[model samples]
Target: MKVIMYHYVRRYNPSLPHFRFLDVENFKKQLDYFAENFGFVSQSEWATWVTTGQMPHQPDKIILTFDDAMSCHYDYVYPELLKRNLWGIFYACSQPYLTGKMLDVHRTHVLCGAFEGRTLVAASEEVVSPDMIPNREREEFTSQTYRNQENYSGVSRFKRMLNYFVDPALKTHILDKIFEHLDYQVDSKGFYVSQENLIEMNNNGMIIGSHSVTHTLLSTLSLDQQRYELEESFRFIESITAQRDRTYCHPYGGTRSYNKDTLSILEQLNTDYAFSVNYRDIDDTDFVSSRQTLPRYDCNLFPHGLAS
Candidate 1:
C-alpha cells in the first residue's frame, strides 16, 4: 500500500502564494489518477491493517493523509474528496485549535512570502536581536543543508536555519516583530479547524489524529517533554471527537525530528501507528517491523505520476 501526504491544498492567495499547494484543478487531476488506478482505503481499514497482519483484498489500495490540518482542507479538499466518496486522515496540531492562534510555521511562511526580496540576515536585523545573527553554528548548519542547491538564496537558507536551530521562543518573538513591522495580523479566524469542524469531520467518516501540541521537533525535546506533547495532543483530539484511534504523525517528521524514545512513548500510549516523511512504499514486512517509522510519499515529489 502507498500513503500520500499533503500540506496546503487551496488556490494561491496573491499575498501568500507560497502557502499554496497544488491548485484545485491539478489536485483534481491527481485524484483522478488515484481513483482510476487504485482502491481507496478508509483510515479504520488502514489502522486495522497496520495493527494486525491482515492485508486488504485489493493490492492496489492507497490512503490519503493531510498534515498540519490547515483550514484549506476544510474549504477545498474536503468537498472534493466527498464528491469522489473518499476519506482522508488529517493530522492536526492541537495548540492552534485550543488557543485560537496561528501555527508558527504558517506565520513563517507568510513572513517569507511578504519579505521575499530581503535576505534572512537583513530581515532578522529589523526584528531579531543582533546577538541572534552571526552565530557560527547557525551559519555552518545552513551552509551544510543547502550546499547542494546551486541557486539557493540567503533568505531561503536562513529561513530553513531558523526553523530547525533557533529557539522556539526566540523564533516566535522574531516572527511577531516582523509581522507587526509589516502590519500583518495572524489569521484571526484561525488557521486550523475548530472543535466543531473536527467533530463534523469525524462524523462524516474522516479520521482525526494528533500531530503533537506545539508541533515542536520531537528529537530536540527530552523524553518527558515528548510524553507531554504526545499525551496532551491525543487527549485534545479525543476530547473533541470522543474517539481515540491512537495514531500520530511526527512533527517536522525528518530523520532526526523523532527518536527511539518517541516510539517508546507511542507504544506506551497504545498508539496504533506513527508516520514519517520518508518517501517509499509499504511492504507486508513493514507490518512486522517499522510500523512507527512507516514511510509516506510527499505529494509534491511526483507531480504528474503519483500512481506510476
Candidate 2:
C-alpha cells in the first residue's frame, strides 16, 4: 500500500506562489494519473487496514492525505475530489480553527513569499537577535541541526533556517514583525478551513484528523506537553467529526520529530494511526512495529511508473 502526502493545492498566483503549493492543473493531472494507475482507498478502508491488518485486494492501492488543512483544500482540492468520487484524509491544526490565528509555519511561508529574495539575516534583523544569525561558515552547522530537508535549495534553505534552528518564540516574533513590515494582511479566509468547512467535508465523506493544536514539533516538547497537544487536538476533532476513530499526522514529521512517548500518548487518546513524513517504502518491518508511526511518501517522489 502507498500513502501520498500533500500540503497545498491552488491556482498559480505569482505574488505569493509557495514552492510546495501544487498548482491546480498539475494536481488534477496527478489525480487523473492515480485514478488510471491505482486503486483509491477510502478513509474506512484505511481504518480497516490499520486495525485488522487486512491489505486491500488490489496490489496498487494508494491513499491520499492532506496536511495543515489549508483553505485551498476546501476550495479547490475537495471539489475536485468530489467530482471524481475520491476521498482524502485532512489533518488539521486545531488552533487556527478554534482561535482564528495563523500558524507559525504558515507565517514563515508568507514571510518567505513576501520577502523572497532577501537573506535570512536581513529579513529577520529587526525582530531576531544578531547573535542568532549564524555566520557564513557556521550556517551549515546550523542547517544540520534542523534535519535539513531532502530538496533544500533556493529559498527553501532560508525557510529551513527560520523553521528549524531559530528559537520558536523569536521565530514567531520575527515573522510577525516581517509581516507587519511588508504591510501584509494574512488572508484568514485563504489561510485555513473553518469549522463549517470541516463539518461539510466530513458530511461529504472526507476524513478529518488532527495535526496538533499549535503545529509545533512534537519531539522537541516534553511528554506532558506532547500529551496535551495530542489530547486537545483529538478532542477538537471529535467534537467536529463526532467519531473516535482518531487519526494523526506529525508536524515537521521527521523521524526525530516524534518518539515512543508520542506514540504512547496517541495510544492513550485512542488514535488509530499516526502518519509521519519519513520517506520509505512500507514493508513488513513497518507493520511489525506499531501502526502509529506509519511512513509516507511525499507526492514529489511518486514513482516514475505511476506518472504519465
Candidate 3:
C-alpha cells in the first residue's frame, strides 16, 4: 500500500505569494483522481493492520496523512474527506496550542514566505551573532537539506544557520528579533486546528496522532528530553481528543530526525507505529519489520498536489 503525506493545504495566499503549499482546488482534484484510480483504506483498516497483522486487500490502496494539523486541514481538507466518507491521520504539535506561540521551525517558513531570500539573508545576519552563522557553503547545505525542490540559494544558508547550527533558545531569540525588525506578526493560535476541531474529527473516525511537543528534532535532544517530547505530547493529545490509538510522526522526519532513544520510548509506551519521511511505498515486509519508520510519499510528487 502507498501512503501520502501532506503539510499545508490551502488556496493561494496572494499576500504571501512565495509561500509554498498545496492548493485547495488541486487537492480536490487529487481526491477525485485517487477515487477514480485507487482504493482508500479507512482508519479502522489501518488499526486492524497494526494490531491484527492483516494487510489491506486493495492492491492500489492509499492511506492519507496530514502533518502539522494546519488550519487548512480543518477548513478545506476535513470537510472534503467527510463528504467522501474517507478518514485520515492528523499529527499535531501540542506546544503551539498550549503556549499560543509560533514554533521556531514555522518561523523559518514565514521568513521565507514574507520576505525575499536576499532580504532575509541580510536580516538574519543583522539579527544573529557572527558565530551563529556557519562557514558551510550555500550549495553544500541546500543540496542536502532541500533536495526535492529548487535550491533556496540565498535562503539556504540562513535556514541552515537557524535550523541546525544555532541553539534552540538562541534560534527562538533570533527569529523573534528578525520578526520584530520586519514587523511581521504570525497568527500562532489561528495557524492550527483547535482542540474542538480535533475532537470533532476524531469523533467522525479520523485519527489524531502526536507530532511531539515543540516540533524540534528528536535526535538533537537528550534521551529524557526525547521521552518527554514524545510521551508528554501523546498524553496531551489523548486527554483532549480522547484518541485511543497511540501513534507518532517525527517532528522533522528524516533518518536523523529520530534515534534509538525515540524508538525505545515509543516501545515502552506501547505505541502502535510512527511515520517517517523516507519516501517509498510500504509493503507487507515493512508491516512485519519496519512499523516504526514506515515511509510516505510527499503530496507534491502526485498529480494536482502543487499549484501550477
What TM-score, over all chains together, does every model reach? Answer: 0.87, 0.87, 0.93
Candidate 1 residues lying further than 4 Å off, grouped into runs, are 42-44, 117-121, 125-155, 304-308
Better candidate by TM-score, 2 or 3: 3
Tens-place lDDT per residue, model 2, 41-151, is: 766666667677776667457888999998899999999999999888999988887788898888777655555545444555555665665434346545544342343
- For 169-218, candidate 1 gives per-residue lDDT tens digits of 57777777777776777554756767788788888888899999988778
lDDT over C-alpha atoms for residue 108 of model 1: 72
Please rank every candidate by lDDT, starting with the best: 3, 2, 1
Kindly provide the TM-score of model 1 when superposed on the true structure, using C-alpha atoms.
0.87
Candidate 3, 118-237: lDDT as tens digits: 888888878888666543453444455645655357776777777766665577888889998888887776788988899899998889999999888787789989989988898888
Task: Please report the candidate that would top TM-score against the real structure.
Answer: 3
lDDT of each: 0.74, 0.74, 0.82
**Which of 1 and 3 is ahead in TM-score?**
3
The residue pairs in collision within model 1 are none
**Candidate 3 weakest ten by summed lDDT:** 133-142
Q: Residue 224 of model 2: what lDDT? A: 88
